[model samples]
Structures are given as C-alpha cells and as structure tokens.
Target: MRMAARPLAWLLLLGILLVTVLPIEWRPVTGEPANLERLVAFALVGFVFVVGYPRHWWLVLGLVIAVALGFELAQLLAPSRHATLKDAVVKVAGGSLGVTAGVAANFLFTRLVPR
Candidate 1:
C-alpha cells in the first residue's frame, strides 16, 4: 500500500500542476465549486503523501503547502489564470486537514497493530 501510494501521490501532484497552469477554457469541470475542487485535490494529495512517506510527517506537510503555493504562483505565467491569496489559503487548509488525518491514522494503526 505504501509503495503504491508514493507514486500515486506524485502523479496527483503532477495532475494538479497541469490543471492549475492550463488555460481557463481547458480546465475540466465537475459542476462543483472551483474552491471545493482545489481543496479536495490538495487534501487527497497530502493524505497520500503522508501515507507513502509516513516518517517526517511535518516535512511532508510543509512540502505539500509549498506545492500549493508554488502552483498558485505558477498561474501568474498562464496568461489566462491569476494567483490569489484566498485560493492558496484554501489549498493550505485542505492540505493541513489531510496531513492531520494521515498522522492520526498512522498513530491509531501503530497503537492497534502488534507489529
């Protein structure tokens, strides 16, 4: 599970970067609010990252936030996209929640499992 999650986490991050810097018209639509999409995307990535690399959870979290911020900043070069603090904040919040959940899960698993 951990082995699979590492690649999955990186793949998700790549997808996020592509979606973020693409032209607005080229972006996919889920009929959901854009902010929700961003939140969920970052959160899922964060959780998988922690699961894949369970050690140094704090570093994983910081890297997640950095990715969020870097992606948002990348928008400035997209011509059709713009960077905003509000969006960055939302991404960060989502990533934080995911990291917390992953850490808790790890904690519980270690406590309950004999090995």
Candidate 2:
C-alpha cells in the first residue's frame, strides 16, 4: 500500500507540473487581486507534496526545484521562449514555498494521527 501510494503521489506531482508549465493566456479580469495566481500555484504544489510524500518532504522539494530549473533550461531551445532569470527565480521561490507548506502540513498531520 505504501509503495502504491508513493507512485500515485509522484504522478500527481507530475500532473501539477504539466498543468503549470503549459502555455496559457491570462484572461483579462476586472479588478483582479494581485498575486492571486502565485498564491494558488504555491498552494496547489504544496498541497500535492503534503498529501503525497508526507514522509519525504525534502525529496519532493528537491524535485520541485530540479523540475523548475529543467523547464527554464528547456525554454532556451525555443526561439519564442527565451529563458529568463526572473521566471527561474519565481519558479524556485514558488517551489520552495510549496515545499515548506507541505512539510508543515505533514508535521501537523503526523501529530494529529499516529501512523
């Protein structure tokens, strides 16, 4: 059961990465609050790690950073998608924040429910 859960968690993490990196136009919204998108991105990634790899938060965190870096490097291959230090920074920050949240959640959950 534990083995199966781990793979499922990884798949879910991959799905989140795909959804995030895919190109999508930002639709214009009337008076949308600032930083909402970033918050959502961070929360979603953090929640995935928290629920998926509760015992290996560090691994998940490292994976997030590696993946983000890989994506940024890949962008260089596309003439239209040049790599930007700013984007990389944002990605790293988001991933780091997410991992922190996941770790905290894992701690709380473990304390709340012995396993």
Candidate 3:
C-alpha cells in the first residue's frame, strides 16, 4: 500500500520561517526566550527535518545550516531583525543536538521494528 502524504511537518517549518523572518514586535509569543529563540527554533526544525527524512543525517545538518544562514541573510533586509554571528552559532549547536537525537531515535526505531 502507498503511504499517505506527510507535508504537515514541512508546513510547520514554513510557518516557523514566516515567524523567524518577521520583526520581533510582529512575531507571536513563542515563550520567554528572547536570545535563545534561534536555538530553540533550529532545534525543533532539525528534529522535524530528520524525523521527516531519515536518510543522510549529515545532509539534513547541511540543510539546517543553509537555512539558518539564509534566514540570517534575509534578516539584513528587515531593520528590526539583525542576525549576529552568535545567534548563528547557537542555531547550529541546537540543530546539531536535535539532529543527533533524531538519528538515535531513528536507529532505535529501526532496530525495534522489523522492516
């Protein structure tokens, strides 16, 4: 049987992108996190990315990095949004952690469930 389409995660990611690119005042309340928001966002994004595409974890990492940098570059256009090197570092770190967890989870699931 063919598997059903799973685009919800990607839609969520797009939403995240929208929120990320918006001005600070325009963005929704994602919690008290102010400086660490980038980290959290990338972590969640990386997690979902790996969960959605379990092949080539490193490629996912690259994509996460590219996305992070792309958003940072996009921020240059918004006077309210300023992308810093520190924020980029935090984003990469968070994504790495999330991707590592995802890889572990995928490995465990594959081991537990017969293909």
Best by TM-score: 1
lDDT per residue for candidate 1 within 13-82, as digits (tens), equals: 9999999999999999999999999999999998999999999789999999999999999999999999
Model 2, which residues run further than 4 Å from truth?
1-39
What TM-score does each of the candidates earn? 0.95, 0.65, 0.84
- lDDT of each residue in 1-115, candidate 3, tens digit only: 1011126446656876787688878898767675577677777777777877888788988988887777777778888888888777887887887788878888898899897
Candidate 1: segments with Cα more than 4 A from true spot: none
Candidate 3 — what's its lDDT? Answer: 0.75
RMSD of each: 0.9, 4.2, 2.7
Put the candidates in TM-score order, highest first: 1, 3, 2
Which candidate, 2 or 3, has the higher lDDT?
Answer: 3
Better of 1 and 3 by TM-score: 1
CA lDDT of every candidate: 0.93, 0.64, 0.75
RMSD of 3: 2.7
Candidate 1 to truth, TM: 0.95
Backbone clash pairs in model 2 (N, Cα, C under 3 Å; residues 3+ apart or in different chains), count: 0
Model 3 — which ten-residue stretch has the worst lDDT? 1-10
